[model samples]
Target: MKIISFGVNNFRGITGGLENNTIEFNNSNTIFLLGQNNVGKSSFLKAYEFFYKNTSAAVEDIYRMNPENVIEFELVLQLDEFDFQKDSIANKKEGLKKWLNPDNLLKIKRVLKPKIGAKISFEKTENYTWDYEQNGWVAKNYGGIGLDTVFQAALPTPIFIKAMPTEAEGEAIINEILKQKANANLEDKDRLELKEAQAKIQELQDKLYNPESIQSYKEEVNKYFQSLFPNTKIELSEKDKTKWTENSIGKSFAIHFEQNNNGEKDETIPTSHERIGHGAVRSAIFSLLLMKDVAEEFERVDNRKDYIVLFEEPELFLHPKLMKQLRTLIYKVSETDTPYQVLCASHSPQMIDITKEKSSLVRMTKHNEGTRLFQINDEFLKDSKEIKTKEELKQEMNEILRFNPFICESFYADEVVLIEGPTEEIILRGYFNEVQIDKDIFIVNCGTVNNIPFFQKIFSRFNIKYHVICDSDAAEVKELDNYGLIPFETGIQKSIYQQLKSDYEKVDYSVGLFHVNVPTFEPSHQQESIKDNLKYSNNYLASDGKPYNENLYWKDVLKPNLNSEEINTVPIVKFLKNIVDHN
Candidate 1:
């Protein structure tokens, strides 16, 4: 079974109405949540665990408080043929009902605090209802199996093995097993059983003491140790026969060390497992648990649809190189035929790079208003044009847009008006309304003024005509000039001011002019407008009552320049109309 979508409300930092946060899994068999630290990346993972397993472990603290702070998580699971076959055989049903039964589908949910318990609830697609007053889902099947049984059947069982076992523990277990298997010239049946038991004990001891033998069992373990402690070396030796000390019989293990520079031998070195660092210990434990889980799955003939794995900072206590390797490991595990779905939260950039495309990344950020979840969308990549290869493009687009969530693709517009910020974008949009211009012209704020060059490049590359309005700052002017764009400097109201600077002489034809300091004239004040057409706003005056100004001055400007029919109406409208006419 595969989860298609999930919804949550009043869950921890998440409150208000249903966020409708969903994840869709492809046949590619992977899903990743990519975001920076503390962005509810971990919270989403916990939510998945809480919903599907009904396990209070992930949400127990939140549940202890107000019962009304209830979190509702719903998953749409796609039932495969194996699930249908198993359910049909178990329930002994026939026809469409047998094939389409809710019980056969994996639908898991949990309500925190309100009802702190974990169990399978029969709320499959076929039986779903929009009625909110149901209080709870009608349980067609209740408490079928514990999460452990299902988890063990699906995910790798988590085994956290530290370094090799201590000599005392190894010896004690070995002696006990040896004593149990010991007998004098036993019969064939007893001898065979004893040998089998002896072999099992030896294997266990060998894993603890013999590095080479353990490598035979798990190659990853050896590789991990080598990468972690490059200077130290380990080997297993047989028990010394002549000097048979009582303390050393079952614990007959020795570690030999050689100095990095010299050939000097250290025969009495400490255990390699003990000498390894804490990070190495953690990695070893994680690897053992993962291996055990994989092995158990092979032992049972469970269908792939029933598996789910949850990881929290899998990169913790790991080196950058190892963290990268861990990512590859995650991908490898996900690619298996078993229905292995992995949800992990990580702060490392390496982790983000691993599954950049095949995941749902929610960026949680704080603003003056409050906390908000900004789902990373395709708009983030609107300024980027570096993607070349198909795979790179797919991953880049997927990473940013969440697969075209915007829905509406084509916007009918001839000329594009690009602004610097959201506020300006909104104000201009409203201004265009006052002017009664057709709304079809695309007016977009490329997020920041710095991105003007990028936006221009993209539009030019696509053969789209566009106009950009930006601040008169040196950097903004330089950027626009670099892109061969005309700058629309805000605020001058006299033709003399335009001719005062030679910079405007270069691009006078293409450039548009306006001033931040200039005052506007009403139709009734035509005589007054002629007398003081160059007057400035009080807000633009310095402490000396003179107009505060910038370096570059406009060469040609007029009163209410932007609205005048000869200047604003003809030039601006013609520039816009030309795009469609020429195209």
Candidate 2:
């Protein structure tokens, strides 16, 4: 069984009911929850935890601490034939099978209306299940089982990895990994060693908890206690327990790192787990969560349990290279035979992988009505037959995004500035630096003027406000080396900015288009002599022997002219300032 969608109301900053605040899961195994802070990304994950645990809530859990408010959680679960066949409870299995919708989905809701002036608890909470015939949640006659019972007994549990995990939590995760390793199948030599170790532990337990030793320890405790109260008698009872459970034994285990200099005995040293850096500790915890061996064990079982991993700020303490590695590992684990879904509330663009068909990006925003969600649709060019096929457009997007992580940051921005090349990106960054305009604006270098329209299609599909800034030119189109032209969009190239505005005029949405009246950007508002120098400067290449350093134009040609008061009034600069002011 897997979660199809979750809804929350009056829980933390989420004040809207399920009707207004439902988050539907995507088809991909990994889903990225993108948002700025305080938009309820963490709160949404906690609501999933609450649905599974059904723990007590605090007064503050109510939205805005209103005493009259009630917290509600709703979940729609998707189940298959395998789920029904593996059920151990015959009664519940039959009832659930009968209650299942035609599409094999079940919607269950938990409502907690806190009692006035009493402890907040789930004892009096209302539970309901969606009825297909009625088309609403039905509280009574649920095939002899309540929604809470089915939800708890049938649904899969989630594993939540917090942003800042405590040391004890880290140890607990490591112990879980070790415990799985111990229980997994082993070779003859390892089996022999494990048995021998267990036998020795048993011997120690027998000596420590025997009747004679218990009597002696009891006398020692009572001797000290009796001195404080002369007339009182202390009694000690022995249950004859001598064996330690697997959890108890695991608690005694500790993780250590070893350092040595190529087989030199003098340099050998052991570093305790506590002494390790936080980055190393977090890496170790998440690395163990891959559970390759445990996944194999799961494959062998007929009734495998499913899990959804909730990770908050997975790039908390890791460097860029490590963040890439961690992101790769997450996708690797999800693709395995083990049933797992990974969702992360992340701020790093490095953690995003929208190239995958199943991967999805959802943005959360706060408003007068509370937190609302927006998702990027997979089919952006489905109806765009005039330009290119959907598959071709998608392939182009994936190829460019694979090599450019900076462009991926546009998914998190409140407003975007789409430029033609790195020259524009550098100039905009410099402009924003000179005049500090506070806004969550992301400038994406589309690599070429023609491709700006494709990216505009993306922002339009996701309802993200964006501005397009490209040159106004009429030149003979040339075939590029790195990229191919969109079919039917070639032949003779006119002003691409004007064509973009014409296309957006037909749509219900509006796009901000900023372009200079001059033929190209290099000569915009420049004198004839400076324009000649700008053209000549493009001939010189940097030390790396690639295309001329894009920054060279910014520092040598653009910077000096930008200082002039007249240059600040250029169309591109003024348009950028407007974006920062309005957004």
Best-fitting candidate, measured by TM-score? 2
Candidate 2 lDDT by residue in tens digits, 17-62: 6776677764656778888889888988887877777767888788
Per residue, candidate 1 scores C-alpha lDDT tens digits across 102-137 of 534444444433533373222221222121234344
Error of 1 at 197 (Å): 16
RMSD of 1: 16.8
lDDT of 2: 0.61
What's the true lDDT of residue 80 in model 1? Answer: 51
Regions of model 2 farther than 4 Å from truth: 89-94, 118-123, 140-153, 174-254, 258-270, 298-303, 377-398, 460-463, 472-519, 522-558, 561-565
Residue 489 error, candidate 1, Å: 20
Which sections of candidate 1 miss by over 4 Å?
6-8, 11-14, 17-39, 51-53, 56-60, 84-108, 112-139, 142-217, 220-275, 289-300, 303-307, 336-339, 354-360, 365-583
| Shift of residue 461 alpha carbon in model 1, Å | 23
Candidate 2, TM-score vs. the true structure?
A: 0.73
